[model samples]
Structures are given as structure tokens and as C-alpha cells.
Target: MSKINKKSMGQFFTPPQIADRLVQLLEQQVGFALDLGCGRGQLGKSILKRFPLARYVGIEKDREHFNHCANLLTEQTIICADVLEEKALSLISDFMPVDTVVGNPPFLEIPISNHLVLEVKDAIPNFLSSGYKMRSEMLFFAKSLKQLKLGGQASFILPKTFFISEQYRYFREHIIDNFSNISLFELPSRIFSGAEVSTCILYFNYRKTKNQQLTLGCIDANGDIENYLKIDSAAAVTRMDFSYHRLMSESGIRIEESETIGSIGGLIHRGNMSRNELVRKSVPHFHTTSFPINEIEISLDDDVKDGIRFGQEGDILLARVGTRCLDRQVLVTAGKRAITDCIYTIKLPEADIDTVIASLSSKYGKLWRQINAKGSCAKYLTKESLLNMPLFN
Candidate 1:
């Protein structure tokens, strides 16, 4: 497929092996199956091969893919319509309360137009509040759940961020509260040929029951099971709230509980300087960068004083942005310096700044920051998230 068409339509066909694996994870007696964003019907073909009698429906937005799916799976129903549209959802709703739902939904971050946003609100009123920015895959999950019957099950190939990123916090909470038999399979990175995004397969049944625990596992490139861990549902939810690093880490070592940076007499906050104000003041504004920051002399006017994040000699500066958060570039200043909003200033008294920096720069500290940071492309750690970091004595 042309790159332009693929990008515009969010059409990334599932690999045959992965498709078979996802289908195998579903119930053998699946009465009816619906594949949302069923690009070229790879998943549908897998499902039919497993259960020949299974009533299958596939929804594809791209006309070319829809035509291809129609030809490939002539026995099944294939609809060419936007999955987010009310009309399309209505068509699927006709197959209401499907027993099994599965697919790799499109992953896109484009803003939903106001008109389409209203359509989503009307269709799945309680899915998410209006005006909340969310990825296209999340909408697919919500709609899938809405279409599923009680005791129904679903397995979706989702970006790893769905389990950890703050943007999906509420969705994670919803899954924890509402779903049962939850299983997470952490697939190795680059499972998709051209896609760089890390992915995990989420399997859950739409039922309410107590004594719920999650089964977590990792699979290699060839789909071999590596290791598995069973964790209490509540514990899994808590870890996901902070970061998935500990839960998803191959090491599988539990993070030792310790006092947070806030409890250790460290004050953490973001820089508050405005660009216009900082430009005129000529202050040495430190941003999250790989290169060293050059010092710039600034006349400390009252306005500039209020804007610049002035750091003391012993204070630690860390990048608050994604991936960069793991860099653990905790700068122990030789003297007071001007910092920018991209960096977080940590003021610690009575504690050795060097010792703290060393600990945070360790493997454990890197994992902690990775989990706490938010966002997919521009990940970052909020002040509250940074303050919650475990401090070593």
C-alpha cells in the first residue's frame, strides 16, 4: 500500500502469526465475532479457520481494504464505514451483544472533529466525557465494550501506553472495575514490521466478579512464552497508576517500598518562566537537552524574578519530558542558575544531592521515572508524579 494512503487511513495490516495468536486467545465456542478496524480481514480469516461455523463481521474504514476483505472473506459480512460514526456503530449494533470482539484498532492521535465528537457522545454516552482528547484506538475499545454482551470477551492489540500513560488512566480504572479474567501479554517491541510502538494484547471478559486477579505474561518474537506473573487485581491497578515499568519489566523484581521524595524534605516543582519574559531577561534558561547549557547574565528585575525558576547550588534539575525522563540528568548546580519549564527543580535540604542523584540515575530510578512519565510521543513527569518517586535512604 502507498504510504500516503496507509497514513491517512491508519491501515496497518496485522501479521498472520499475530492474528492467529489473538484468535486462539479467544473462546473456542465464540458464538459471533466482530473485528473492529478489520484491515484486509486477516483476523477474520484466522477466526474462521479456528471456528468454521462462527458468525463473523468485519468493519473496515478504508474502501480498498474493505474491498479486499470482501473478496477474501466472501462468506462473512464486511462493512466499509468509519467505526467511529454513528451509522457504522448502528450497523454493528444490529449484531448487538456479540460474544467475542477482537481486532487491532487504528492508532491515531488526530483530534476528532466537533461533529464526530458529538456523534460519539450520542452513541456511547458514558464512554468518555465530551471534549476529552483521546486516541482513536481508545474509542474503538469503548465501542467494542458497548457492543459486547454480558459474559462476552475481547482481545485487543493495543499500544503499551494504554496500560500506563496518564491519558488512559480513567480507561485503566474502568477496565479494573468492570472487566474480569483480565490477562495482559507484553509482546516484544517491533511486532509490526514498520510500527515502532510497543504493543500488548489485552484479554478480558465483560463480567462483574470478585476475587479477580490479572495474569501477566511476555512473548518473544516467535510467540514463545517467556515468563508469566499472577498479581492481585488491586495491586496491578495500583502499579499501573504509577507506571507499568515494574509490572512489565522482564526482571520481575518488586520495587522495594520507600519514602517518596516529598516525604524526604524535597520540594519539586516546574519552571514557570514565559518565553517572552525570559528572552528579554537574557537568563541562562536550562531546557531538556543533550548538550551543556551556557550561562547568560540577566538583570534580576521584579518581573523576571517572578518568572525565572532560579535554582540553588545544591538543588537537582531533572528533565521532565518522555524518554528523556529516563536519562536521569540530575544536575547538581555549582551555583544558582535559571531553569526553564521543561526541567523540574528539586530542592532537598539535609540530604546529599550527589547521593540522591546517584540513586535516581540507577536502574531502579530509571524504571521509576519511565513509569511515572506521561504521554506517548512527548512523555513527561508531572510535579505530583515526580514527588511520588521513591527516595533511597
Candidate 2:
């Protein structure tokens, strides 16, 4: 596959060491093992290597990977299909009550309109609304869990968002409510070649327990777990990443939150237009670059703004998306420029503006964002996430 194609599809074939880690996490030795987004078949190969008698199926969306995996795992059934599709999930009937599920789902953003998501909308709850879409890996994880039988076990090599991001709180809560024996194994950020994505292995048995203790481990380059800890599942519900938990404790950072950003009169608005819209309407438009912003007085076309507030003095311009720049913020200077879509514009009380910005840049703010920010590399913070973030006293 071309580098561009692989990048576009977010395909990072699993390394053999990671495959061993995934296999190690699963407890069941046989019967109905399912691999979703089974890129290049490394995981399936590992599973079958350990459980030779197990019935295994590897599903891959990329035909190239599918063919490669098919050839690689000749003993297992390899199917080329979009795992997120409803048709793909309908196969739960054919392979109902899987004993173990494993895969390294592609890291990509997909719309919520996937037939399966629409079908299960009422059954499953996602925090993202229509405008914001679903993460493909999360969807894959959810679907796999749906097919897992009672007493089944699952272990997937998932991106960091699955462990740390607040956007998927529902998934974390689901794990606590419906599963036990949860263990999260953090992997290196550079685990995948040419990708800087942070990842972890999520292991759980699909059974409930009260006050379950969850294990947090880290696997070094040799695939041997080098560091480990145990904590109550409830304690890690808000932020599951061990690094975050460990850092918070080690640094001795004390944080106190008395209110949310929204409660403090920090009204959030997302930009709602593009360069094309700007060309047609001739309105002042600003992307994330329009900075050193002095007292600005540019606002989107009323219809263009779609009732969203933008472009005013004392407003906070926040970089809404980017792995590196996402946490950046700039005080609106005395000038004229307005942001339309993706980026955020917050209109706050004149008195509260400086304090809010300062608090956001403080140690407490960084700590909150480290866990609350969404996405893997290019982080995304939704308006709701921002508004609901605790404002430290």
C-alpha cells in the first residue's frame, strides 16, 4: 500500500510483539475468537498460534491487508469487509457468543451515520452529537463487545483515547458496569512505525463485579510488562491512563474545582463556515492562524454564524483541534477577525476573561486538559467538553 493510502486509512499493521501482548491478555484458550479490523493478520496469527484448536475469524476492511492476512493466516477464516458496517456486525448471528475478541482497529474518524451506529443509537449512548462524529476504533471496540458472550474475554490494542479521553466516558462506564478483571497495558508512543500515536491494550472479562480492582501495566519494547499497579475501577473511571494517575500523585498537584467553564459565563461557540462560504459572502473570516489578535470586531454573517457567537473583544480564541496546538489559547486583541468552524470562540464576562485564561494556562488547567481532551494525535475538544470542564477556584 502507498504511504499516503495507509495514512489516509489510519492503517498501522500490528507488530508481532504487540500481537503477543494482545494474545497474552485473553484468558480463553479456544472457541469462537473474533478479530475485527485485523490488519495484516498479526493478531489472528498470534491467537491461533497459542490456541490451535480455536475457531478464528479475521475481518479486514483494506483488501490489500485482507489478502495479506488471508495468506498469512491460512488456517483461519479471513473476511474482507468494513467491520463498522451493520452488515459486518450482523454476522454476530453466525458467530454468536464469541469466547474472545481481539484486534488493532484503524485509527480514523468516521461519521455517526454508519448503519450500525444508527441502529443501536437508542441502545448505546455516545457523547458526541450530530456535528461531531465517532472515532472508528471506538466503534469497532463497541461492536466487538456487543458480540462478546457472558463470561467472554476481550483484549484490543486501542489508541490512547480509549484509555484517557473524556469523549468516550460512556465506554469506560460500560466496562465498569458490565465487565470485570479489567487491565490496561500502556504501550510506547512510537510502537507503530511512522506514527507517533500513543496506544494501550484493554483487557476485560465480560462479567460484572462490585468494587472490582483493575490492573494497570506497561509493556516495554520486549513485550514484557515492566511496570504494574492495581487500583479500584471507580477511581480510574474519570481518567484511566496510568501515566495521568501516576503523575497526578507523584507531582503532588492539588486541584480544586468549584464550577464548570459554562457555569462561569464562558459561553462556547464553534465556527460554522469555510473559505468557500467566505468567498461568496465577503465576510471577514479567521482560521486558527489569525493571531496576535488585538481587540477584534469581526463577526460571521448572521445566517452564516447560525446563531453562534463570535468575534468580540475580550473573547478567548482557542485552538479546538490539533495534537500540539489544541491546548493553545490567545487573548483576543484589539482588532477585527472572526472564526467560523472547528476552532472555538468564547465570549466571557470582561472581568472573568483574564482570570479564566490564566486558570486555563495554569498547572491545574493542563492537568484537566491532559485527560479531558479528545482524539489520539490531533486532539479535538468539543464545545460540550469545554463547557463541562471544571473551572478551578
Candidate 3:
């Protein structure tokens, strides 16, 4: 597929090996299966190979991909329709109580400002309780699970954020309250031939009640499981990403119990974006790109200054997003500066903050970041996760 169409559609065709791996994540033999957004039937083919008798149905929305699936899975049902549509979902319910549902859905957000967004979200009742910023992947996931039988299972490759970001806290709690046999882990880089986005496999069974144990894995460099642990689902509901869970499970103490960067006033706030016009005398704002940032300017305009969280001399700035440059920290100087949204700032006494920054830049500190930083590629650090960091002990 052309790179342009690939991104515009938000569909990444699964590699053959990855498809086989996803099929293997199914714990039991499949009697009936459904593949959501079954790009080119890669997963459907795997499902058939694993369970020849499994009544397989593959759904694809894109015309080209649907055509490819139609030609490839001739013996299986290939529906050429939008999986998020009510009609498509109702059709899938025909095979109610499906034994398995598998697919790698797209990860893209719908801006609430769009006129169609309200109608676009009308099909996803599960997300109604959460924020308006709807993600396509989560929509598919919620709908897929609704059709699951009592003991039915599901496996989907999802963006790393689904399991970690606080914005999706509602869904995490939903999973903890409803599923069982949950196994989640980061996939090795380059799973998609050219796409470097981070992703993980989520495999679980549907259960009316919670109390399921959760298994988390850390992938080794060679695309294999390096280490893993099992914890109660209740314990991990707030954050399902492995890194933070592992850190907290082993050594993370509570904000009240531990001496942490938060011990001294905590992270003040994320840097605000430069909202005003940058004229000759306009305040200059530094963002993730302005790293090695010398002291900068905060917007003092009536419209922006109130929201501007100024950086103090003893303040430390950390890049909040990106794959390569994330975790980059800068010690703020006395000069005035405006910070962009991509930066998180903490204010402390100069010497104390310096000591903390030095420790965070240390070898183990790097390891802490390497482990706790979520995402398979464009890794990120959450403010709560950062504030929870243990002081040098």
C-alpha cells in the first residue's frame, strides 16, 4: 500500500508472522471466530490454519483491502463495510457468542470539534462515559467485546496509549471489571515493516465480574519475552502498561510514603504552548525542540499569561513525548522563558533540584526511564509516573 493511503486509512496490514502469533494467543480451540478490520485477511488465514473448523468471518472497510481479502479468503465471509458502523456491528451479532475476535484496529483520534464526530461516536456506547476524544481502536475493541460469549476470548494489537494514558482510565477500569486471563506486553520494534509506532498485544477472556489475574511481559531485544509477572487485575486497573506496573510492583512507594521529586512540591505543571503572536518583542516559548533550552519567556499577554506556568531558576524541564528525545531534561536558568505543551516542569530549590537531576541522569536513572517509559517506539513519560519516581535510595 502507498504510504499516503496507509496512514490516511489508519490500517497497517499485519505481517504473516505477527498474524500467526496473534492466533496463538488464543488459549483454546476456536469453534467460531471474527476478525475486525481484517486487513487483507492475514489474521483470518492464521485462524483457519489453527482451527480448520472455526467458522471464520473477516471484515474490511477499505475497498482495496476488502478486495484483497475477498480474493485471499474466498472460502470465508468477507464483508466490505465499515466495522464501526451500526449495520456492520449488527451483522456481526448474527454470529453471536463468537468464540474469538481478532484484529489490529487503527489508532486515530476524532476531534470533538468536527461536525461528524458526534454521529461518528453514536455507535460506541461503551465510550459514552469517557471524554469526547474518541479513538477508533478503542471503539472497535468495545464493540468486539460486546459480541463475546461467556467464555469467549479476544486478542488485538493496540497502540501503547490504550493501556497507559490517564485519559483512558475509564476503559482500564472497565477491562479490570469485566475481563479475565489478561496478558499484555510490548511488541518489539519494526513489527510493521516501516512504521515505528509502539504497540502491544492484549489477550483476554470476557467475564461478567472482575478479580482476574493480569500477566505482563517485558520484551527482550530479540522479540521474545525477557521477563514477566502476574498481578491481580485490581492492582493494575489504573495503569495496565507494564513498565510503570513493574516499577511500582517492585520498588514504587506511595507519594506519602516515599521521598521523591514530588517530595518537594511535585511537578508544578506541563509547559503551556506559545499561544500568542510572536512579534519582535513577543515572548519566545521553548518546546520539545528547544531542548538544551537556555532560560526562556512565558507569555505575559492578558489572554495567555494566566495559563502560563512560568519556569523558575531551580525548575527542571523534561520532554513529555517522542521516541528518541523523550526523557531529555533541562535545568532552567533565571532568564525568562515560555514553555510548550510538550514539556513538564518541576520547581524546587536549586541545589535540591540539581541533585535530583543529576541522579535522574545517572545510569540507573536511565534504566528507570528505559523501563518505565511506555510505548514500543515513540515512548512517553506520564507526569504522575514521573512524580512517583523514588528518590535515590
lDDT of 3 by residue, 139-191 (tens): 67766766767888988888877677677676677677677788887776677
Give the residue spans of candidate 2 off by over 4 A: 90-92, 119-132, 253-393
lDDT of each: 0.71, 0.73, 0.70
Residue 17: error of model 3 in Å? Answer: 2.1
Ranking by lDDT: 2, 1, 3
Tens-digit lDDT track for model 2 on 140-256? Answer: 777777777889899988877756656667767877877889999889877887677778999988888989888887898778898888878876778687776665555454334
Please provide the root mean square deviation of candidate 1 (C-alpha atoms, Å). Answer: 5.5
What value does the lDDT take at residue 14 in candidate 2? Answer: 84
User: Model 3, stretches more than 4 Å misplaced?
Assistant: 90-94, 111-132, 208-210, 219-223, 249-256, 266-322, 330-345, 367-385
Whichever of 2 and 3 has more TM-score, that candidate is 3
TM-score of each: 0.77, 0.67, 0.77
